[model samples]
Target: MRAAVYRRPGPAAEVLEVVELEPPEPGPGQVRVRIVTSGINPTDWKTRAGYAGRMPDGFQVPHHDGAGVVDAVGSGVAGLAAGQRVWLYLAAFDNRYGTAAEYAVVPASRAVPLPDDASDDLGACLGVPALTAAHCLGGNPEALKGQTVLVAGGAGAVGHYAIELAKHAGARVVATVSSDEKRALAEGAGADLVVRYTDADAARRIRDFANHVDRVVEVAIAANLDLDMAVLGSSGTIAVYAAEGELALPVGEFMKANTTLAFVLLYGLSPGQLADAIRWTSGALAVGALSALPVIPYPLEQVAAAHDRAAQGIVGKVVLRIAGN
Candidate 1:
């Protein structure tokens, strides 16, 4: 198998290298996948750059999301068979082999069957971003119906999925973007309204459109606290996924409004929460409720370049083509 590996964390160019290795086989409750497309998330680059600490294994194949076909199924695994098309999540969490290779072995639970209608490209885009979005939107589609949801950084990978998932759950979505290009992306994802977060009257605009935001899928909580606080409804929840710097809560205002702050870290999600997110995301995919952002493709050999692009926060999904099919 050909895989991209990093022996020690550092710059993508300095660390990532393509190499040949024996393809791994599945263990009990695991499945081996013949990867078709590997998706790069911010986590992929960050981990490769050592942000999350030392690598779990001495060497790493760095990607958690991909779309592939089941090459083999391990003992005790049920409902998944060799040759089944699947999308994988958390493939490299504690394993040295990830979907950045021609093959990857992962727990069966992380390999979800991709719908026949969903392309491999779209399937590759689902894992981290879509699952995180589903979790952030409260993991219950029924609970979101008829509510107004606010998505910060609606042009981002997670935010793009957040907007679509919120809308698919029957919620009216309001997205905040800094640029017209991003506004178009959010709008195309079906956000009911898009407002420039930098606008002087951004909060007022959101308030005018939705009355009050019932839930918030926040990307930069520290940066958008005031904007979020201004439009959040009483008793609303702010589900924060990413933040930079420390945030000092407005204790008095939060107490008065009964605001709930939910921090979402995809890798740290409890099993139950992860399951719910997967179920919801799968359901949404089956119904064609989810759509992929524009994809930027790179060959497996260009893994380092792909990592750099994702780290630069490109507007579309960055995916590595691992197989011709």
Candidate 2:
């Protein structure tokens, strides 16, 4: 098998390369997938650059999401078979081989079967942002029916999926975007309301749009903390995923409103939280609630470009098209 391997942390072009290696056979409870599309995410680049944490030593394949066909099932695996099409999530969570290659090996449960009608593009987009969205709201989604939810940076990968997932769970989702283009993207994703994050009256409008903000799925929590705290309804939970730095809480106001501040990091999600993300995201994908995100493709040979593109904080998903259709 051929894969994008990084020996050390640095610029994508400087550190990443395609190398031929033995394709991994599935372990006792894992399955080997012939990767078609490897999804590039911010964390992939972050980890590669040692920005997320210290870079691992030795050869490492990157990417956590992919869509592919099952080629080999491990001895103890059940409910999946060779030739089945599946979407993979957390492909490199604790493993060395990730989706940024011709093949990847992951646990049986992480290889979700794809709906026949769904495109490989959609399947490739599901794992990280979609699951992260699900993890953020998965705990109390049932209670969110008829409630109002605010999603910061709605056009972002996580926030884009959050808008649709929240709506599918029956919340009236209000999304904050930086531009008209993003506003349209959020609207296309089924957000009930769209507002500019920089507007002077953004808080007032968000509060008015939904009566009160019942939940907030924030991508840029540090940048928008004051805005979120201002419009939060009583008993609201603010699920924050990304932050710039330390967040200073308004203890008195937060206490008075009984607000719950939550954080989501996909790797640290508890088993129950992960299960909910998988279960509910599966339903949403089945019903076409989750759509294919805009993609910027790079061939496996250009894995460095894929990493660079994803790290640019652009308005689309970056993918390594490893295998041709």
Which candidate comes out best when scored by lDDT?
1
lDDT of 1 by residue, 1-325 (tens): 8999999999999999999999998999999999999999888899999998885567899899999999999999999999899999999998888889999999999999998999999999999999999999999999999999999999988998898888888999999999999999999999889999989999999988988999999999999999999999999999999858989999999999999999989999999999999988998899998888799999999999999998987899999998555
Candidate 2 lDDT over residue span 1-325, tens digit each: 8899988888999999999999999999999999989898888889888886666656789989999999999999998999999999988887889999989999998899998999888889989899899877755568768888899999999998898888888889999999998998999999988999999999999877766888899988878989998888999989988857777788899899999988888888877888888888889888888898898888899888878778878998999888554
- Per-candidate Cα lDDT values, in order, are 0.92, 0.88
Q: Which ten-residue region of model 1 has the weakest summed lDDT?
A: 52-61
Number of the predicted model whose TM-score against the real structure is largest: 1
Backbone clash tally for model 2?
Answer: 0
* Each candidate structure's count of clashing pairs: 0, 0
Off by over 4 Å in 2: none
Task: List the pairs of residues colliding in candidate 1.
Answer: none
- lDDT, candidate 2, residue 259? 92
TM-score for candidate 2, residues paired by index: 0.97
